[model samples]
Target: SNYSEEPSRHPSLKINAKEPFNAEPPRQALVSSYVTPTEFFYKRNHGPIPVVDDIERYHVSVNGLIEKPKELFMKDILNLPKYNVTATLQCAGNRRTAMSKTRTVRGVGWDISALGNAIWGGAKLADVLELVGIPKLTSTTPAGGKHVEFVSIDRCKEENGGPYKASIPLSQATDPEADVLLAYEMNGETLNRDHGYPLRVVVPGVIGARSVKWLDSINIDSQECQGFFMQKDYKMFPPSVNWDNINWSTRRPQMDFPVQSAICSLEDVNVGRKGKIAIKGYAVSGGGRGIERVDISIDGGKTWMEASRYQKPGLEYIADEERSDKWAWVLFEAEADVHSNAEIVAKAVDTAANVQPENVEDIWNLRGILNTSWHRVHVQVRH
Candidate 1:
């Protein structure tokens, strides 16, 4: 296992686990910058990190349902056209801790910082697929399959000590708007070992699990991968089912997540003489549906103030004429009047008009995944 060689992690991250190395940056650190620094990026590992001492020898095998099954070395990938994408990667279980507070759920307890946005540099997955003889996507293409499976080099205990694996629908893999990439650089620097050095897939606008790290191989198949992560886990169920009655196969894996938002202003701040309290936070939506607006409520939903949105300067999204690709989270801020005390709440609306639930109970599932409820935090306002 590559556990022994894993590099030292950032001291600022709040450690959730020591063995698998799950950690998230503090809320303050997360909102401090538009693009999260590589060191501050959240690290979510399910198993041992595969050590690649000699990157030149490392190769990613692409096969299954393609005319030319080929082995792409680091040099081969670098030779292709380089594309830059700015997107946020959020874990499916990002707010698991908040959900656990409502009811018992099994998984790593992650804080709000289990998400980050970065500028990625790599070759487009679609270009690579076509180069390997996978025909250009058409209404009738992908003649051999409907899914693209990605396997990781890391050995995982979750799969009973086997290599980790996951898959996405072929449509998402081939869609030019998806901006899927074989990323070699993060935030303008060569990827660090912790962040899938040498090579990894960056599936923008999807859950972090779909962005397989230490990428080992790619295969096109008739159906989604039957790997443990793709089938038995990372799924959502209605609150009605419990451990005894729940059938893992009955539910489908979670793909694009629901509209979500979080508040970053938690510490008590003095209301200035202007009688306005400053509020700031982050908001995001899945599946390329950009956040239309983020509403902030200071009086427990009686009234709301819309927050202004901002992102990394000069970053362009990959989108077609029909729509804009909004894969990155928007940093927002607003000011509202407050006195004595108040319950601050935040909710976001996606471009598709999908709004976050007002309360967690309304959308609570068996596993506490996809908690896109309005984030609330009480603050003591001083004169």
Candidate 2:
């Protein structure tokens, strides 16, 4: 496997893996701003980072179960009505390290920052599907066309050296409200090569795996994508089912992540001078659900304080608002008085009332995906 062509990344990024190139921003860098800097955004790749230089030759093929299959070029996509969407893309395996502590699980070890929010600029998938003769809100399945698979240009060993791919329901793809984008821009700038250059899919409110980078081809199918990541990996299995009893067929592909929150201000164990300390971090939920509340417990889980949540600068954040940040994370902040050692904890509740589990053991899975357990950090308050 050749790795000489990997793009240069920010020096501050904490490297988790070197081969497939998975790294995330430091905990302090995550809540620095409402929108994550492009350089600081986490890089999660399955294979070698692909580079797209041929602008004219680069095109996305829309085929499979469509009436009019078409190969759309850059100009063709640009001609469609463009929209900018602000959404957060989080890896399903985010915080896998914490889950592994309970029992070993298989997958890359990711910290608390394996996610980022960005303003994606591109043509809507609903509009692009309309170009292929599929109307918006295409829910009814006539010819068993229910799923939309997105194939990528990046090659990974998981599929025996095949391109990375995943899929979503056709109804979700055709829903303009879903905010599925064939993104060519990130944070008002042309997407860097590290992120999918030229084109990529930005499926808001879903796991980052569904948003295939390095755009290649779009396939409409009767069934969900059968790719390695979709079929074999990213499934949630109970603790009773180990590798021996685990049957991939028993579970479906994991999609939207659960409500999650973490305190970025303190380390795993912080020795802070006895005083009122400021605690800040990010809280988010999946499937278009907004964070309803972020509860902070500085002295273990005995007493809790509701952290003030905000998305925009100097403004209160209200979940369920008809705003673009609905799919984005809310930065929570609070001040707590700690006279001695304390166990800082952060628990988030989505607008749908989905709360993070108090313990990782309850939701522990073999794949180590979606570790939405309450984030706890031990802080040693010194006098």
Candidate 3:
């Protein structure tokens, strides 16, 4: 059960745990490097790592409210034409620490490193669904439609129950922009067992939790999957609510990530001498809106400077450019001259003009969902 084998980690990654799979790259990992290699990328798993020794026998089942219930063996699924997409897989709790500072939240305590960007290669979910007799949407979908749910092949015994499953709205499932996939390869190679060996659901723009790993089955229903992940966990609450006053039924699970950014350059303890320093990190917005700009402030939020930009992963194609569809993180860098010791603050604004809230306390919720506040780090300017 020891799944802590270090694949290929960036020297800059900050270790959080060595077993059961937990670790984060420094914030700079998002900005420092353009393409996050598979080895050094952050790995988040909720159960015992399942090792898939054979792909030949691997099969993915697609059922529920469909004209035809079908089972897709690996060969059959792969035989169809293949499509590739570059996407950023981010854990909904990427900056849980920031939320925890305001109030205690439930679930895996992750910092900024519980995310990674990769070029996933597989048949598009839409294409596969068509083969299975699901109709493609030609116009706006009717309201009150049921949701689509995905379950992981990697199962675990729940403390109070049987198994764990995650679900997302059918709108997200079928959205053309959503570009969800039944991914078999990560970064051009077979997926690592720890990441999800035979298959996994890649639900773009939503949290990593909904992108269930080791995907076993896909179900379309008139209601959201009543699993713990959908009905009980990952829900957001008002700022005034606390553990003692929780109203679980009234809250809603988080679907999209709020606009967020972080500082990746300097660790918490290291202080650079007073001079010129480069600040870099990544910013992304949920619901498919691209990041517009990132603002950096040395003295809290009093003054700000725009960070330098890099091209998004998939949308643009420079001759020498890496993956053009930036479903992954967008790296940004800004240079500032340090004159005196001060606290550095960083906030990102997305193309939608959605900016991180000024303070975490204002947005603090019982479950700690959507904690997009200005990222601040204190450093000394010593000469």
Candidate 4:
């Protein structure tokens, strides 16, 4: 393992695993800023981080099922049109710990912080694809390409030590409106090694797994990449489908996440001075959907109250507003009287009117991925 080369991490992160360095920020710290700091952003790696020291020698090969195959150098890519897109990338396995408690499921034991919103600066993938002779919004290449696969330089155990890889539909890749980027900068600065230093793929509105870090190449394939993460791991399965009777091919890989929100102001259980308790958290919907509203339930899911949400502080957040960032998460805040012990909950509705299911059991899967159930916490009011 290349663990020796791993970069130092923040002291505040709660380490869920040591080998691949899977960790998330303290819940309170996560909601402290509109744009999560680079140091505080959650780190999710399947294997040892790859160290790329030579920026001049780095190049991403773009080929397979295209009219012109080209190995684009780093300098060539930098000269293209640059766009800074604010997007949220959430892990499909986020909140797996909550799902695992229901019934032991597989994969990383993440809390709520397996996601982050950042200003990703890079060349639009649609523009890069054009340089390779494929026009924008062309679903299928004339030579029969259907998917755009991103190959990473990082090797993971899931692939039997092969490099990490995944793909998106070629149509999504070609649609400049999709905002897919070959990102080299994050949060207004050059990306650190843990966040994919030299180059990476930032597929806005998709699960984090599809945003391959340390990108090595791009392939326009006739079908999606047959990588382990794409074919075996990230797909959601019915609760009844245990490892014994599981069929990996039955369901497709998870892309856009459903409407999800979490209250981060208090811990799972908190004892506070009796009075009004302020609640704060974040709400995000995938596929470029905006959060229409966030509902807070002080008496568990018995009843609800609307919470105020915003992306930039002090500015009104209207989901349908033309100037609002469609891909970023909106922070939600609310206040409620807490005279006694209470069960507090929060759930979000996307612009599309998609509401989160109230119970984890209703959406429980064998893989324990996409646990977007209502977030509930207990508050003990000190009398």
Please give the TM-score that candidate 1 achieves against the real structure. Answer: 0.93
In the range 1-383, model 1's lDDT, one tens digit per residue, is 45687789888889998778899988887778888888889999987677888887899998887678899998888998887788889998888898888888888998788998888889888878876776546222345677889999888787988888899887777776688999998887899888998788999888888899998999888888999988888898888888899899998888887888897766423333435666888999988899999999888899987889886543334333322237889999988877657888899999999999988877777777888888887766555
Off by over 4 Å in 4: 313-324
Better of 3 and 4 by lDDT: 4
| 1-383 per-residue lDDT for model 4 (tens digits) | 77999999899999999999999999998788887888888999989999898888899999899989999999988999877788888889889999999998988899998988787889999999999999989999989999999999989889999999999999999999998999998877898999998999999888999999999999999999899999998998877889899989988988888889999898899998878888999999999989999999999988989999888732223223333268899999999998889999999999999999999998888888999999999988776
Candidate order by decreasing lDDT: 4, 2, 1, 3
Q: Number of clashes in every candidate structure?
A: 0, 0, 10, 0
lDDT of 2 at 212: 93
Task: Tell me each candidate's TM-score.
Answer: 0.93, 0.96, 0.89, 0.97
Q: What is the lDDT for 380 in model 3?
A: 86
Candidate 3 displacement at residue 167 in angstroms? 1.8
Q: Which pairs of residues have clashing backbones in candidate 1? A: none
